[model samples]
Target: MLKRIILILLVFSSSMAFSQNGENTWNTLSKVEIEKRFDETLNFEVDYPTFSEEVKKLNGKTIELKGWMIPLEELQGETYFVLSSLPFANCFFCGGAGPETVAEVFSKGKYRFTEKRITVRGKLEINAEDPMKLMYILHDAEIVD
Candidate 1:
């Protein structure tokens, strides 16, 4: 009975450790890389598509993005913010919400809304396009100090 209990405890502990470690597998990229890639336009003959390809390269990758947190009216309960290239007033809400202007971020918990700029690190998912009308979206995310 003692040996069986010890084995059960070991299994439970190992599973818990695995679950904790699994969430930390995503890798982070620098802000410079994101800016450099955004500035350059790659020419490809094949119909692989630029946005899709870029997204595929970034998928399952954790990256730190710096921008103002601009919330959407539609997404209330869910913590959704856009990482804009420029100021929120200048870039957003003027039909200027381009591919770079919008980055839908879903935080792990309730985030304190602020006007100050912040850096967020989370697993990026580029394939999940918004059903309504949106450009870039990131899911299963968390804010990094």
Candidate 2:
């Protein structure tokens, strides 16, 4: 009975760890190389990010991210917004961080703007060729916390 109980506990712990795979996804996504590339349409050089192999492996996979909501249009209950590693005051647009510090979140439902940190889960899509779009985009995202 003691051995059986121990085995069950070990199995449960392992499963729990696996279920939290996205807990530190932001750290892995940070592994990127940025370079300036000239865009013919824009007539100027734009910063382009090349995702690392570790980051590419996460593409098309469901992951979770924790960050602050950034409203672009000052609209309430937005279905899409930017998620930043830092708060609005220290975010990328604020000139305190880089583009990689933020991800475009396209949620399934409208999310009210808040100063609190929130967690979201969705399938991550990497955009390397589009200069107009963010480097990281979370599709079908929903608030987890």
Candidate 3:
């Protein structure tokens, strides 16, 4: 029947649309690649600007960033952690816990804080100014073993 055919077409179209939106477009770079780009070339004079530029270029794109998780005070029963580019002492928050000190990451499920080092694979989001205050600021974020 024409009705059955129309229903099938509608379902197919909807599924295709969902699939397109759900596509993962993040690119993964190896440690070697990161070193090649940042190691020797990164120094006191140009580190921050160069690093910021690279991250900016990957905005809205998926990237695997490896860093440490620094724990913050818990609210209610949920534990909050900060993903930092360096060790806890070097964290921007070490002095005053500034906005750039850490990134607020909420685990998908119940998780306990153990090691400070962790690697995260997620969509690169910028100017997330306050992850705790915003909803859905970062998408499809998961811990990488």
Pairing residues by index, what is the TM-score of model 1?
0.53
Runs off by more than 4 Å, candidate 2: 1-19
The order of the candidates by lDDT, greatest first, is: 2, 1, 3
Model 3 TM-score (2 dp): 0.47
Q: Summarize candidate 3's per-residue lDDT along 1-145 as a digit string, tens digits.
A: 9999999978533322111234322211111111112334333221121124444655676555455566554632243455654466665567433333344555454445544465555564554232224211234666766
lDDT for 31 in candidate 1 is 14
Q: Pull out the clashing pairs in model 1.
A: none
Cα-lDDT of candidate 3: 0.44
The residue pairs that clash in candidate 2, if any, are none
lDDT of 1 by residue, 53-73 (tens): 444666666665656666555
Per-prediction CA RMSD (Å)? 14.9, 8.7, 15.3
Q: Would you give me the overall lDDT of model 1?
A: 0.50
Model 1 segments more than 4 A misplaced: 1-52, 71-78, 95-97, 128-133
Best by lDDT: 2
Cα lDDT listed for each candidate: 0.50, 0.81, 0.44
